[model samples]
Target: MTEPVSISLTVNGATHDLVVAPRKTLADVLREDLGLTGTHVGCEHGVCGACTILIDGAPARACLTYAVQMEGHELTTIEAVAKSGELTPLQRALTQVHGLQCGFCTPGIVLTFEVWLRDNPDPDEAGVREALSGNICRCTGYQNIVKAVLAAAAEMRRGAGA
Candidate 1:
């Protein structure tokens, strides 16, 4: 058996010191160890964006990342998006537009767009589709998702201007 390695991970603005196996994926460490189950594991493979999380402010697949590799890196999960207990504009738009169904892919989608919308406050439908390509949603047919993203972008832009 491989010995556990102690490492410090900064997640959601909090630092966690944990002893985990070197090979354990960040998804496992986040969900099983840290109790942050919002980052769901879906294909286990990197192809599915279900395990997407932010690594140093960029979206990355938690399933493909080893926990030990996260040391000194800033990680953000869906749990951190609405830390104030209120839904973000994206979350609110997703709900209002019915952008999600089943919800297995919602967290990843939300996380992806949270960063995407920051970089692209005025994205068109094509750009939104491209950004959303990484996430696979089995339900909702993506129409509502696209609408929600556009809606969120506009709402966010308005919020920024205000």
Candidate 2:
């Protein structure tokens, strides 16, 4: 058998050096080796966006991206989004708006929209829905998610202008 490939990458602000198979996806490395289960794997086909993560400050598909390719890259998972056991404004907005139900897809939605929110802190409802099209949610029918995004956006805008 071939030897495992050595990879060095930063995850959630922590440096990690792991020996992983070349075929191992970023999701596997994050969940299995790094003990970060927040990045879930749903379709595993890159369509679900359940394994979405921030690579170099951009949203990426962890399931479709191999770990070997992530060398020297910085990854941001769901755990990183929450600081000191406190939810971010966006996360809190999600809760306030009741955006999540089963919570299986919440992480992906959070990570995915987080990038968009940062890039566009003041987005309309249609824009928010368009940005969220990549992430699928079976519960709440996405109306609550849209509400949460809009609320968070409005809050952030107010803060930025203040």
Candidate 3:
């Protein structure tokens, strides 16, 4: 029998001490252990973006990271995207523009767009598509998703300036 290893990690600005198996991936920890089911599991081989989470503010494939390996690193899942009972602009924009359908990929899409918008606050249509090319959303067919990102970017900029 293998003993569970104790490790500490910072998730969404919260620190937690967790007992985990060495073989347990970050995805399992976030979903099964931490009860954060927003990060989906698809193509566990790392090709699909469904399992993407922000590790230290950058998108990472949670399935490829072991729980023990994330010690002391800051992890941000979909739960962190919302703060103070308010949704992030990108999340709200997605809903307003019909950027999501099945909703399976919404979390990843939100996180990815959050990062992209930070770098390209006023991205044009082509730029938005290029930035989001990494994520795959079968339901929205990319049109609404792109529009949502653009709208969110503008809103975010306006808020930042205000």
Query: What digit string (tens of lDDT, one per residue) describes model 2 on residues 1-162?
Result: 367888898998899888988888999999999899999999999988889999999999999999999888889999888778977778999999899999989999999888899888878999998999999898889999999999998888888883
Q: Which stretches of candidate 3 lie over 4 Å from their true place?
A: 1-3
**TM-score of candidate 1 on Cα atoms, chains taken together:** 0.96
Over all chains combined, what TM-score does candidate 3 have?
Answer: 0.92
Model 3 Cα shift for residue 135 (angstroms): 1.2
Best by lDDT: 1
**Local lDDT at 30 for model 3:** 91
Q: Residue 149 of model 2: what lDDT?
A: 94
Evaluated at residue 157, the lDDT of candidate 2 is 86
For candidate 2, give the lDDT: 0.90
Give candidate 2's root-mean-square deviation (CA, Å).
1.3
**Worst 10-residue lDDT window, candidate 2:** 1-10
Give per-candidate clash totals. Answer: 0, 0, 0
User: Which stretch of 10 consecutive residues in model 1 shows the poorest summed lDDT?
Assistant: 153-162
**Tens digits of per-residue lDDT for model 1 on 1-162?**
489999999999999999999899999999999999999999999887999999999999999999999999999999999999999999999999999989999999999999999889999999999999999998889999999999999998998893
Candidate 3 weakest lDDT stretch, 10 residues = 131-140
